[model samples]
Target: MSSKMEKFSVLMSVYHSDNPHYLDVALHSIYDDQLVKPDQIIIVADGELLQTQNDIIGKFISHCPNGIAELLQLPYNVGLAAALNTGLEHCRNNLVARMDSDDISSPDRFQKQITFMSTHTEIDVCGSYIDEIDPVTETFISTRKVPLTHNEIIVFARKRSPFSHPSVVFRKNKVISVGGYPPFRKSQDFALWSKMIVNDAKFANISDVLLRMRTGNDMMARRGISHLKYEIKVLGYQRKIGFITTGQFIHVLAIRTFFRILPGNFKKVVYKIIRKCYG
Candidate 1:
């Protein structure tokens, strides 16, 4: 079989600290899935991993029913963007998928997504909905549906993350064409997606909740003010890119501030309501 038709690279950038606890859930999901065999599960770990890699991941690496896994330990923390870019450099296949250490994917996640991408030639990036599971609280935190249209995605960043970064799959050629992920601020995925869209990259999403994300937004209040600061920065970026005018950006800021001042879960409820109303 052709290389493009045969192999699919799965890039998983993780910290060594994450091992049998959360890592197993993520790896086992891929292993249990019968559809796609990873070309290589490139794990960008740290020096702390070198010792534990042999004990923890070594067995799974050998026994993964589909893919053969490998380890890449960095001397220091290069951050998520750098780690993912390093893995992408080693990817031999045309297709790429992201898997976080903490999320669980549907059994057919890779197979279904790669198949859709194969059928749809125009689209370079595709993401799926997520069943946001708060493992700590042991409660279902509702579902997150990624944007299905280019325009929806542009609007998505203004509120919550439209594309679950770990749930996204894309063509390697297209990702490289846009210069891959940038090591900028906390929003590396945001930066990369914006760059891709600005370059006319086509995006799509599977409406189904094909992944389960471990929700940890309970601490948003501690950094509430900082979160607003990031939104403002992103709005500024939009203005610079000509997506939103200065006046429109300020309008968004005004509405965001108004919502912030409301009672507990008010903004959250509003977002859920908007999803339902729109759906």
Candidate 2:
């Protein structure tokens, strides 16, 4: 399918604490470096941003084609889930690609995803593998791959996320039909995927790396008590929805909680082992 015939929107949320430089690079990758540029780039400013951040956004906007970049500034920070839900409301296109403020997308990311989605009309959501890079050095760290078929995705979702949240392009209406993203501080994507799965929304993942995700000690540090709480909440929802059996929930929760409590360094090692085992 020609990208020109299937116009799509790029959706992203940025907050005060995000790195300005990273955000600039992310926007550039999805626009200047992309083979198929989005028809519209909708960025939700979750809260007040620094002057530097605003300046970077201004630079990006100035370089974009007229009406291609849209910035929605919120009066206050509403976190990721709420911010994304707000952004989704403004997405004029049926297909919306999700991008993180810190990730660098491959030049052909949008082209590949749009082509796959256009051909696979039944699949409402599509994601792909990601190459994890060091935040400081910008060197390759690992490749996080997800299941590539609907059945495999459903089975994988019972234990872990079936798709990389930042690497996904999904049908906007399908996501909204499931109540959009739940208002959670963390693991919102996990909950959203579970809801979509139970609601019979089809899913798939391209068997190729489409984005380079930044991961480092700071990322590992986030897997603490708060993250564990949200993880359990998502697991409980899965159990209630019958997406996962009680035994499966308990088993997965036990393992996740153990890893969550580990020191940042130890958690990093555990992450590598888990990825290697599953990759």
Candidate 3:
């Protein structure tokens, strides 16, 4: 690890569904990148991965220096939130960079994020925009952009997720102090962000894209009646934590309900409009 990034760990959670080959690509993108290399890569195995997945992880660990890649295995399949919470407890540094098992980080990602966190000591969490890509061919499909300032992020989080989950690097102590990621089935990150905001944690995101995220075709399948239920539940939690008012919670629920009933194509348009309006 380089001196510039010696204080951070890359935290990722993997499970059975994640593609082994994609995981290989993702790990290489982090380990074989630019001037700053992470001091530790803390990968939490959410559940039992396939033999192939285990082999892929072994291959990567063989190349890393001893103790650089730490794998925390769980006996059963825990959801993302719980898995991440466990990973957080094992992190060796205060600054932890969040990574998805299948997303590719840009060569300058660590350098950019580390520099930003070092200079802006008050910012507890920092994220960046990402390019959505077709996983098989790795072709860019679109971009997911977020607000770059603290106030904008707070406003945007009222309606949608303000930070890309896989592109964020945050202070471990701050996150842990706020109770870490809540154990929500679907909107865990959003829920955690809401809690962090209520705790007065400063947030920021770079305007430039710093990661390539693989989009599953069935990603939209996760957003229907069930997803709306989860969102409403998250909204309720946010209100309970005093992050949002009752009126704001009701307004968000109505908008989300309307979007849930719309056809897939129309929902895409509505989401695009929302992103552009918030962006």
Candidate 1, 133-246: lDDT as tens digits: 776653677777567876787677554555889999888898898788866546678767777877888888888877888763443323355566666776666567765667
TM-score quality measure for candidate 3: 0.94
Summarize candidate 2's per-residue lDDT along 71-151 as a digit string, tens digits.
999999999999999999999999999999999999999999998888778889999999989986789988988999999
Instruction: Count clashing residue pairs in model 3.
Output: 0
lDDT comparing candidate 1 with the true structure: 0.72
TM-score to true structure, per model: 0.83, 0.95, 0.94
lDDT (Cα, 0-100) at 276 in candidate 3: 57
Which one wins by TM-score: 1 or 2? 2
Candidates sorted on lDDT, descending: 2, 3, 1
Clashing pairs in 1: none
Write candidate 3's Cα lDDT for 128-217 as tens digits: 999888889899867888999999998888888999999999999999999999989888999999999988899999988999999833
- Best model per lDDT: 2
Model 2's TM-score against the true structure: 0.95
Better of 2 and 3 by TM-score: 2
